[model samples]
Target: MHKYQKLNIQKLYQIYIYLTIRLLMNVMWIVLAIFLIILIFERVAERLGIDRWYKLSSIGWIFLSIYWLSSFIAYLDTDDFVNMLLTLLAAIFSFIIAFKIIIDNRKYPWKNITLWVTISILIIFPFYKIPILRDFLIDMVANHTLFILSSVFNASGEIITDATIILNGFPVSIVIGCTAIESMAFFAGLILCLNAPLKRKIIALVFIPVIYIANLFRNAFAIYAYGNQLFQFGIIGTAHESFFWAHNVIAKIYSFLVVVILAYLTFKIFPEFLTLIEDIISSFKKDVDK
Candidate 1:
């Protein structure tokens, strides 16, 4: 009985340690996110010649306070309502700070930085927590892609379900990441970051849908290649699989080529974009040479 008791105690201790570690990890992630935001704000402020230590410090404190309060509410297990409310308040606060910074630094490239950061956040984080919107977007992309594939392969493919397609009995699932939203976001960010006219920006935005259409072609090609065994090979009675080539290599190459062509055309339309790209490339080369 004593041995069993001791074992139970050890197991309980292990579980306690695990929970403690998990809690700490969660806290660390929150703190790290806050720290990064503060750091980016300070860097942008310094660049814009608005480096007020007191204001930045206050902003950091506000973020830290929000994080701590939310953490406390979460620990109490009193629903996620309070936590979400606090998060919304914190976002508003951050936005106000960003707006003020932009207003005070109209001469600097604050607008570009703001646009880039905002679009990046929207792309990287699923702030839109609506499941229906997400599902609808994925379903649309998947269905359209499957339709294209069917046309190309003479109706050899069908959509099995939302965001999933079956071609020649091989199933492919399209997730949110596969919808090319990130690439569109990147293109939008680039266009907004460039020192271009409103007309050019609008024109660039008009072409944003082209990325989604290109992604459809990319998906169709990959699915068709995989289904038709376009790259399969064998050597001396040994069959070598080409799934990796079809799925990874072909998909990536197609996407990269499409983006490159689109970017080239866009840069031609907006010469400032080409200059920005050249500057970035030169700076990167210099850094590498160092």
Candidate 2:
């Protein structure tokens, strides 16, 4: 037999063993995370310190739990069209990644996490912007986020646009609970889950809101741009599309780029954060190795 064929057979055997073990361990991890989350919630509620932190953590945990549950349910409910489609997609992607990992002999098993995160963000971002999906998730997120923000800042929190938060008296509005936040959190959480460094996770978390805020300011600035370009100078109807395009697509993409920049900056400026993240990775590595 050829060397490559031998390697392939060995890899296939290793994958079979790994998958069998992973099925059991995955359940354990899910159960353990759930138990710890519940314990943390009880402890936080009992001893009042940083109520906002607890609320945020609670929201995070709840959504995570639901996500896990939904994914599991999705696997089982093969009869429904949506469920079957989702399951098929999941299977295809999972198999592709698994095969790639086996063939590539990657140092870190979790390296494909970024790919999965990107896929998830692409799936979610469109839904977040589309009218029907936007209304549903935005309403839920905004209401929950507004309740948290109001309780924390004691402001009249109301969502004006898709992500804009309006304070009753404040002239400038704050943007909260947007798709940007969801996108960041998803990517960050995925990195963290994949046993990436803590600094990257922190960078991801920090940059999410930065993107949202930058977009908000961009919108505000575009208002001035529109007024100056159109009303103040010449009333060119066709030229006004420049203002609209600037306000819509360009600003949004630029803000996303800012988030990418911030993530890069976090790694450069706060390099030590990686040590802490590596420690976490080491701990998990120890467990997996054992």
Candidate 3:
């Protein structure tokens, strides 16, 4: 009886420890989100150069805080879909309010809009959890990627399932994060933020397709190499066997290089955007130096 009672005590203690760790983790996430929101608010207020911007931003921050806190708690409760929807709604509402406030302020419209839009995109992009939209994007990416692979490799590639391409009987699954939507969205945000003519901005949007194509090419090449066992030899062989290094390191390096080249070409065409990019880079450099 004493042994069984001791065992029960140990089990209860373990459960208590597990619950405490989970609660702490959730609290940490919420705290980090709050810090990020506060930083964004300060930046926006400074950029707007108005005291009212702080007040307006505080309202938005409140909405965001509720979204973050509730979402974290809901995640703990395992209601992920509802949490995502609630978070999205809250973020959109906050964005609308903040955007209106920025437009009303009107002092450096381009800069303010750019900052708000970029921050808004960064904030809400990760929380996207709509099932239908996710499936649609995956389908599009998978089908289009397989088509491109077939055209490039002169080999038959088919979509074995949604977000999965089968090449030579090897199945490669493409997740939402791997679909190049994030890169395209980032470029779009940058273009929208540019202090350029409407025509120039529209012209800049041509790079979106370029980025998508580049990503498709990257994915196709990596999948081909992986399927055909091309990069399976040498020092890379061991790493390739481990999935993380294979896809994230080798594959991501290639894709990042492609993006860098594309970005260079883009900046060459829209030289005005380079100024902003330079300023951003210099600011980062200064921060690092400090």
Candidate 3 lDDT, tens digit per residue, 1-290?
Answer: 69999999999999999997775545424433543564467667678774554344434444454555566556665423444555567556555444544444433433433354444455335534567777777787777778778898666877775578776666789888667886787677767666667887888788788878877777777677666656554654453443333464566677668778867876876676677656545544655697
* Candidate No. with top lDDT: 1
TM-score of each: 0.60, 0.35, 0.58
lDDT of 2 by residue, 1-290 (tens): 99999999999999999997775445424433433453346456547663333222223223334444556565574323443454456545544433433343332332324233433444455554467776665555555555655554344545676555554432222333333555455545444544456665665556556654554455444433443443333433454544555454455567657757765675564554355457546645655697
What clash count does candidate 3 reach? 0
Which candidate number maximizes TM-score?
Answer: 1
Q: List ranges where model 1 is wrong by over 4 Å.
A: 1-49, 52-114, 127-129, 234-242, 281-290
**Model 3 poorest 10 in a row by lDDT:** 105-114
How many steric overlaps does candidate 1 have?
0
**All models: lDDT?**
0.64, 0.48, 0.62
Models ranked on TM-score? 1, 3, 2
